[model samples]
Target: MKNLDYAYLGPPGTFSEQAISAYCSKYGGKTHACDSIRDIVETIVKDEVDLGLLPLENSLEGSVNLSLDLLYKHSELKLYREIVLPIAHYLLAAPGVKKEDIKKIYSHPQAIAQSGDYINRHLSEAKIVYTDSTAAAAAEALKHDDRAVIGSIRLADIYQLDVLAENLQGDLPNATRFVLAAKADKDFSDKNHLGNNAESQFKTSIICAPEVNRAGVLHEMLGEFAKKEIDLSRIESRPTRQRLGEYLFYIDLMGSSEDPDLIEALNEVEAMSGYFRLLGSYPKTVIK
Candidate 1:
């Protein structure tokens, strides 16, 4: 096994950290934790790490805009692979503190947003405080008895806190999709699963923008995919951050970029759209 040093979002206990650990354990690698997603990206860009794991989307919460924005901002980084982790948010507090004693609940905005209905139903009186990361929320809650943090079970265990409530998010089918990114593209020929092509599935992600002063341009852009009968799994628009009204669309399609049909669709979209950027094309992880 080659010694692989991977970067992940952490001080510890963030879902990104857990995903990195799980990925490393399953694929044979060593991991290093970083303070922020930007830090992880910086590590990868600087060649300090082999890969950086980041959360791109959550099933319950929708897109992680910051990650998407960062993807746009950092042109050097590329999506090498992706993985999905089952999400389980817990209400954690210091040992001996009962759930009723909690006056404030702290967590990342995404977590708080996803678990809003549950918080309103159960901890309605509790004030919500947003932290940079879920692990930071747990660390903050550890210092006070009146605060409970909504985070993962791994967070509670790492911080030696008690789980006041398990699966507090209310949504039982919660899951988060993370991307494994690196500065260079990946070649999967040496991977273990190459021998078995039975379950192989690939997905390609791209960012594109439609041309200005063009009527029905968006329709024309999409028509390219429709004409090719390409399956677009997801499509989202984010501000291009260039001008006030300019926007960029992020798309996920169900076939490899190498596929002939997908290639034809992409070429057409590229010719029609003002700009386009291919993030990556890699095997899809089936979340069980």
Candidate 2:
């Protein structure tokens, strides 16, 4: 394997950054930390780096819509790898500051959502302040004794903040799914066939928009998969933003795109869909 240049969402200490760190620990790479997921996606789309990593979904916080939207819009970028990182949230405050001394709480929105129960019960009086990243929240916390942040334990030492409380996510075993993306410009005759192998477990993601605004179209679309005996792992809807009721469907098929059955099924579905996109066909990484 080559030494890849990776981009991630961060100012360091974010789960996205941590995910890339874990991924590259065995195979070293330089990481470019972007301020947002869109930046990371765009960087990959533009081929500014060898790869990009993004937090796609969370066990507690749900799907990251920005990631989905960017992927849908950038059909040239392929999701080649996935990393499921075990995430744990912690509460940090300035040195010598106790939890009761904190009057305001700052963190990324997903961090806030994941710690909802703990915040409601323990820091109900604290004002909730959201930041772009958990590391940014920790950066903000360093300036105020009355402020606290909910983030990873890795952030405490980075900003010289004290761990006001450990595992503040209500003892839940939280995890985030991150995807590795790269440009899909290689031809099939090229070596590795764009990173494909017979032994790899694969997942193909696609975006579907119905051609006509009619009833039972979604059911009919799904029937195409069922009739072909394709197993869908996930299905999510996203607003196309053209109208109030109009939406786009995202689905993950539980097999490789190279499979003849999948190719046949997709060919039929594509004809009926107003717009359809094959985001990627890549190997699935299962983390222990």
**Candidate number of the best lDDT:** 2
Clashes of 2: 0
Q: What is the lDDT of residue 33 in candidate 2?
A: 89
Best by TM-score: 1
Per-candidate local distance difference test:
0.79, 0.79
lDDT of 2 at 150: 93
**Candidate 2 Cα errors over 4 Å, as ranges:** 59-63, 171-173, 186-200, 241-245, 286-288
lDDT tens digits, residue span 145-229, model 2: 8999999877886788888777777666577887788887733333242233456678888899989868999899888899889
Q: Tell me model 1's lDDT, rounded to 2 decimals.
A: 0.79
